[model samples]
Target: MATGADRTAFGPMVIVAADQHEARPLIDDPWARRLLPASGRLAAALTKYRPIRRALIAPTEKKIPGLWASMLCRKRYVDDALRAALDEGGIEAVVILGAGFDTRACRLPALAKIPVYEVDLPANIDRKRTALTKALGRVPANLTQVPVDFNTENLADALARHGYLPGRTFFVWEAVTQYLTEDGVRRTFDFLATAAAGSRLVFTFVRKDFLDGTRLYGAEAAYTEFVRKRPLWRFGLAPDRVEAFLAEYGWHEREQAGPEEFTARYLRPAGRDLPVSEIERSVLAEFTG
Candidate 1:
């Protein structure tokens, strides 16, 4: 049985899928197309896992709105850019923070040659293992599942135990900072900074203004309502402040992608008009330690 803590930790997978399902159609990037099937599968699994959540978990009757939001949100660009960066850096190992039913390890052939580490709660790891076992016959050899509670376990120590070298690693943390407190986010970044000298981190953060209660209610009322019931609410950070925050710890920003630019490069060609409501309006940042 999953403990209460474990349940809370793993529950976000369902929520993320619910969020993606609600925003996928508007996303015109090839990466979104790759993710849609996995997202849809996970959404269905979540609904089957809990009958009560089925109705709420289902995709909205209209799909275009969701796609519109995804394109505007630019998460797909963040993911793609991170992968490209890792490839360019000749990174041999990849760590995915808070991975939730994400199928990149299995689907991305270029990544098949590299070792992929997925860090999440034990329950989620177990669920992923079971699901992948049934779907793929077995977990891929290049993929390593590391289970840990970020609140209690030291990330550096956990990664060390799992054979992650302090040097020569790339970390991908997407759409998770908003769920962490300011202090928690700082601590995690601090840990990564000290973990390895040449390590790189790819992460995203929502702009603080976007999370203001009044603005959230006015612009993303539905999402605001959905997140309100969760223990972890969105906590946005200012884009300008991000550089200063990292500079203090000897980390340097290498590249950045905003929502609008991301959509233009990855989705606009698909002829989609992204809605403001579904967009994440976040900055995707890459930093080197």
Candidate 2:
């Protein structure tokens, strides 16, 4: 059973799951829809467990499917590219930052072959455990869950305690940075920088201008307004400046693509029919230490 804090921490799962559900059929991968029912269950649980925040999340859920579809179309390519880089480098360990109901550890065969360490708030982990147990009847053998409040825990210390090898790891920070403060994001990267020189990072960012625009869908605007009330959460990156930002922290940009480029590379021809204008508004980046 989750407490109020736990429920609150697991709130984002609803949004992500909702987004995946909407976008799954549009994806070329046959297994995409497999993630939907589980995501829906988790979303419902959070709603029942924490009504107010769930209500706040509802509006976002509406916009999520399309945005998520657009994002995942690109992310699938990025994730595959990152996996290829890891394979080429002989890196086997992976740490997923803010792993919210994400099924990569279970769904991606190549990723599942490696040991995956999923880091998130304690409540979210618990919620994920429950959801996975119910959906799959068992969690993946290679998936390990690490529970920590990023504000209170040192990522390095937590990784050390969890037996993460400093020299052989890949960190995937997906749609998580926007919820964190700039300093928090920097600290996370700094900690990763201390890992082995070859360790890599794959992440996505919403350009600040996307948030500044008012033409987003109704649900998008509602969620944005809600997030505005939370001081810790806001999209805070300009696509042009991300490479410079990473350079300052000892990471080298290995590859980067705007959403449109990503779609062109990974998505099927039909998936490409979706409007690309909004997709180009954000960027995905890969970095190597």
- The TM-scores of all predictions, comma-separated, are 0.73, 0.74
> Model 2, stretches more than 4 Å misplaced?
1-66, 210-224, 230-232, 276-289
Model 2: per-residue Cα lDDT over 1-289, one tens digit each: 2212333333333343433433333333332233334555555445434454346444544655345345555456546756676669767688888786666787677876788999988877876787677667877888888887665578888877887776566778776776666777778877866766676777777556555554443446434553554433455577678779888776777666654564576444545344333523333344455
Specify the highest-TM-score model's number: 2
**Per-residue C-alpha lDDT of model 1 across residues 118-157, encoded as one tens digit per residue:** 9887877887787777767888899988987665567888
Q: Score candidate 1 by lDDT.
A: 0.59
Give candidate 2's whole-model lDDT.
0.61
**Model 2 TM:** 0.74
Model 2: pairs clashing at backbone N, Cα or C within 3 Å: none
Q: Which pairs, if any, clash in model 1? A: 25-67, 26-67, 26-68, 27-67
- Count of residue pairs whose backbone atoms collide, per candidate: 4, 0
Query: Number of clashing pairs, model 1?
Result: 4
